[model samples]
Target chain A: MSSKIRIEDARRFRVGDGFRLSDVDPTATPGFSGSDKDLKKELVQHDEEIGVLQEKLHAEKQNSLLIIAQGMDTSGKGGLIKRLLDPMSPLGYRVQPFGRPTEEEAAHDFLWRVERALPKPGEVVCFDRSHYEDVLVQKVDALAPAEEIERRYGAIVEFEQQLAERNIMLIKVMLHISKDFQKENLRDRLQNPEKLWKFDPSDLNARAEWDEYMDAYQIALERTSTETAPWYCIPGDNKDYARAVVKHLVVDALRTIDPQYPTPDFDPKAELATLESMD
Target chain B: MSSKIRIEDARRFRVGDGFRLSDVDPTATPGFSGSDKDLKKELVQHDEEIGVLQEKLHAEKQNSLLIIAQGMDTSGKGGLIKRLLDPMSPLGYRVQPFGRPTEEEAAHDFLWRVERALPKPGEVVCFDRSHYEDVLVQKVDALAPAEEIERRYGAIVEFEQQLAERNIMLIKVMLHISKDFQKENLRDRLQNPEKLWKFDPSDLNARAEWDEYMDAYQIALERTSTETAPWYCIPGDNKDYARAVVKHLVVDALRTIDPQYPTPDFDPKAELATLESMD
Candidate 1:
């Protein structure tokens, strides 16, 4: 609630008809007019609120949340999750990061593994990378035949619609970053001994096809960003601002759900009386 | 480690020959010779070390950790987890809380669901309550045949050994709390609207058979605490002290594993060169 970005204004970042990935400036901090230091303080406040809302969500045990975070390598998906969910109780949430599928996973439909990982009632799960990859990476890399890839767009829309029907709210976020920003991040990983473990050679292959990946992402967004589970595109070059925007989206969704503590089934006075009466 | 309880002294809390449930003082804060304020500061320091070691564990991807928290109702299993794990990145950890089995879970062998929830390599999972319940609650409530309950102890020991052989380090913890402490906690939950959702009528039933459950826990600890997976009993009347001991135990295990940031498999210079040369 302390956010400078109103829920209505944050809607500007949502993917829509004719949405152009290149039109958004990754470095610009829209809606937030404060200094970085101020944003940090505001984030702490927002996290505290997220913590409370998450507890109510857990206590209600009637609905679940699935937050799908998709982006190119080094686009800050992991960083965004840490800022967004660490302040909340770990008991009420999970972070499931999808990697290149195992042999068993690759053998099934693209959504098989994803369906198994959806949040149970009263839980919030963040997907560090998700089924969106089946379309984005699968399409750009030609891992699947063109005809099969074309069919996946409708398959994904229907899959998400089923989740919405099941009372599982979906927050789909695409952390949009420029190619130059990713090169800087990859270089930082290569140069820092502490970060060297994160630098994978495969990342270079992905980087080489950045433009194609962008095109694939644009197509996926256009096809799948429906009214039920629309996608939000956050400019990720400024980690703080992007993280703040994600916090707003999660808070707004939780606010809409407005989970409340369930009313106790037994009378407290009677239960206390019975407890004391026990020998 | 900043812990006043040296790992050897902490071993004193382990169950072994002539271990008696009644002998241990649930209110004593042994090993820790600090004020509550000092313990609070020490816990923060320990959590920072946990955060760093956990990342290394994730990077290495050769080992995993399973922390099992078991205690009487209202002994602060959830609170201990919030303190011990929330400071770390949510990406690297999961909290799996086992409630009374559903129809499907009840139909399977007791360990079936737990087997499915074990941590993967490079991950840390906390079982808020776990397979130990099969022996504790099943024995107390006579949920299964006496002979069947008798078989579970051996089954559990063998199961944990399998985990240890697979490089999944297990930290089994029992939060020892006085009955009086539990009574106060339940009263607090009943009195507070915010916490009312957590108060269950069945908890009173368990409390009524306190002596029986204590006997059950003692028997389970004696039978199942092995070299591979030892149970650490922390005094729970003082929550801060209990949480600090659990943090130290986890930190010590991670230190023993001593996971390292993996060396890059590819030549970094050549990869960088190739990356730069790509069109």
Candidate 2:
């Protein structure tokens, strides 16, 4: 696939003004124009580039990258994190998994815990299920009142704007998986003993509320995907294709950031001589 | 103050085997060998060095630094953080304040919230109060059973060791203040309308159990001040002196780490030529 065309096609998946979730097909691989083997080769190249860029970002120490992964239970957030970050230095990246909020987190504004989890300068942080849960799960289950949920969308946009202003490059991705795809994933988890640990009965309840969850995600994506921090709805039925697309998106952002190794403050020639003398 | 001697004197306050909190004179300024003006000047220098070194650390991005501040309610934890981090870039630093844990945090191990608050690589994080509180306040108030508190000390040692193994420079400081000094601070808070918000009724209750709290601290410092994360007891009665001492300690750690700006991977000359051509 021509990377230029692939990037443009991927951009089409980005939520923008008047976008609709129904317009996206979970099984469609818009960006991958190649066979599976060729796609794998492309992913490897992206991974190598990401690794180098991450080091430069670390050296630059002026900005941070935050990737927020949100999706249904079987949509592969964990798998994506493992694959994307595996080639990078552990020191420069972290994965923060947002599970059930502890009582203390619930006491404050929903954004409080998320603010605490943001990346420091020169770091890349991924949130596996992020603050979007406040709008998604809360809205579907009616865990929060309607007005409060409405307020959250506004809060998220403002919060994301502030993050961008603070030099945090925020990428929001929703793993778009069909109901049938999710059912297959759930069945696989149940049938395979090794994968059974991943299964949760509560996931079935979420599945029952599938349409409600999708509506919640649709509204959230439409309202909060601003010029800064756009949301990309990745086709999750083809896990390998989805992973490659996400990798491309992340690499594209890194290329745009284009962090360079900072100039040395001290004289390296003199420092090297001093080091040799010490030996 | 002679910063070299002050750093040494501060070392004397670090909790080691057989250390006792009662033996520390909270009113003493053991290392300030100069007048107030000289001490102020030294602190300013330390601040400048800290700011520069922090930048280098951020550029290097191989390790992180975590500073934990623990003390009585009015013992100047907030003031110290503001003074220490004020000269540094906000992008590389974060401050996490631990109050009463919410119901969710309470359900997990005491270290769960703390682990969540740890710094990312190339970052400096300060905790206003940390896991020590689980043993300090919890033990003094019988908030947790004796056995649980006992388990926590061992857990803390192992946790700190793991952090050290992961290239996290852990510095724990206890702002030691006399009961009389605390009383004066509390009285000042009550009298000054501007400071009234800082006062909590709980402070009085804590004051009532002063001796018990000291005993708790004495035991805690003895049990958990491992070589990996030693505890420094900074006299808190004189805020300026305390701030300078903390500054020196932090600067010393940065010097030991000696982070340097990384070498460029690409040819800067060629890149500059390309950019010049574009312009």
Candidate 3:
């Protein structure tokens, strides 16, 4: 496993014009050329590096990070998040899961709750399901007026830009799992007693209209992927490879930020003497 | 490394009537006859077990947990919290660090802010510092009126009882460190460039009045340690042992809760068939 995995052209995974979901293979591990053992070894190293960067980010208390993970059910969003943050100290980052809105949340504008959940300076926050749900599920199920949904694209772009200006870097990930993979995952949930609690009968309703959801995601990805807050469409069938790619994305973001420990105002030698002299 | 390290007498570390801070040795590792290698192996196993229990707790969505870690500066509160929650999913638990009160926070009652940060059902919340700050720092520094500080003790008892009734189990741990140990830690912070950012000049002020803080903690522990929420004074000089004991304390609480995966309300066989038959 190389120390540098050629993240130079990571943008090749970004969504652009005519970015059809069908064009990308869900099973592909684009840049990584490693066995399963190698991938595991690489991930351990990534975890350690990410951990160190996260501490520097915390110590600097200047920039912040927000990773929004949007995926269809059983796309391994939960597992991906676990692995991405496996080595991080719990204090430095937080995971925010967005489910169906409650009455209060529903009453407010779509961005209202999201704005409230934005990361503070020095914090790394992950959104399991984020504002993209408005475009994906809402558009697919026709939960809102089509015109209202159309207006949200520009609103999202502006919102993300504002976040970037505030030094809150955003990594929007679309975990692209094939329909067959989702079926297999749902099957596992149904068959495994330990995992049965995760099975929801309503999950089938979304599966019934898979193509429409795909179209919705494609549109959202094209509209939302910008230089500041770009969306990385990760191949999700191979869980290990997908997690490794996401880890790289995070490490790359932190590296770009280049957070450093703040220089102390007080003299270190004098403080040491003062501390040592204390009764 | 036995499967069950006898936690039957875990309360031996708890503060009770006639409790004194000086009595318990900071270096003692009671009931643990393991070598350093054994402790490391045992921790890995504990991590896995805690992961399973945490999942069950999240699945059941019935009970919640609150672990409060209060210790003097340089006593390893931050490190202890990291190890305690290392294995849990970020979504299932939150680490809330309570620093000096902000203007808005100071305007509200002490418990007001704490109540807002409490874990919901099925979640685990850890407080690096907590409402105890009101009793500890407030009492030692005479920040509040004497009568007001005296009244907070009974209020905390009632507050904790209310939490217990709501099934939010609380584990309050005071990481007991000797003054000599703290001096060594502060000296390291001053010498190590990577650690210099953590060295605050005012940390020595707290060290200067160490005995006052200890007296304050002793009083607070005796008053607040009840059947519902007990304070565990763990020896902190041995960081590994302190962390292991805290892990056992958490694992024991989860075991007591015994949160089981919810029995599927929908028939699994039927759901499996339904999912399989879907287009």
The numbered model that scores best in DockQ is 3
In terms of docking quality, model 2 is: incorrect
The candidate with the higher DockQ, 1 or 2, is 1
Instruction: Give the DockQ ranking, best first.
Output: 3, 1, 2
TM of chain B, each:
0.96, 0.96, 0.95
What's the CA error at residue A256 for candidate 3, in Å? Answer: 0.4
Encode model 1's per-residue lDDT on A19-82: one tens digit a residue: 9988988888887877778778756666777888899999999898899999999999999888
lDDT of 2 by residue, B1-279 (tens): 243336787677788877878788888888677677777776677777787788777767788899999999889998787677756655466777788999999999999999998998889988889899999999999999999999999999999999998889988999999887887776676555445545566666687788889999888888888888898988889888888888888988998889776554544444333333331
Alpha-carbon RMSD, each predicted model: 2.2, 19.1, 1.9
Better of 1 and 2 by TM-score: 1
Better of 2 and 3 by lDDT: 3
- Judge the docking of candidate 1 as incorrect, acceptable, medium or high: medium
Give a tens-digit lDDT track for model 1, residues B1-279. 233655566667888778888899999988777677787876676767788999999999999999999999999999998897866778888999999999999999999999999999999999999988999998999988999999999999999999989999999999999999998898888889899899999999999999999999999999998988888877889998888778878888999999999988888788777766764
- Model 1 DockQ reads 0.75
Query: Any residue pairs clashing in model 3, and if so which?
Result: none
Candidate 2, after superposition: displacement of residue B129 in Å?
0.5
Candidate 2 residue lDDT tens string, A66-100: 99999998898877776677556555676787988
| Chain B global fold similarity (TM-score) for predicted model 2 against the true chain B | 0.96
lDDT accuracy of residue A111 in candidate 2: 99
Q: lDDT per residue, candidate 3, A1-279, as tens digits? A: 534345753557887666777888998877777678877876666777788899999988999999999988999999988988887878899989998988999999999999999999999999999999998898998999999999999999999999999999999999999999999999999888899898887788899989898889889999988877788898899888888778878898999999998999999998887877776
Work out candidate 2's RMSD over C-alphas: 19.1
Q: What is the TM-score of each candidate against the true structure?
A: 0.96, 0.54, 0.97
DockQ of each: 0.75, 0.02, 0.83
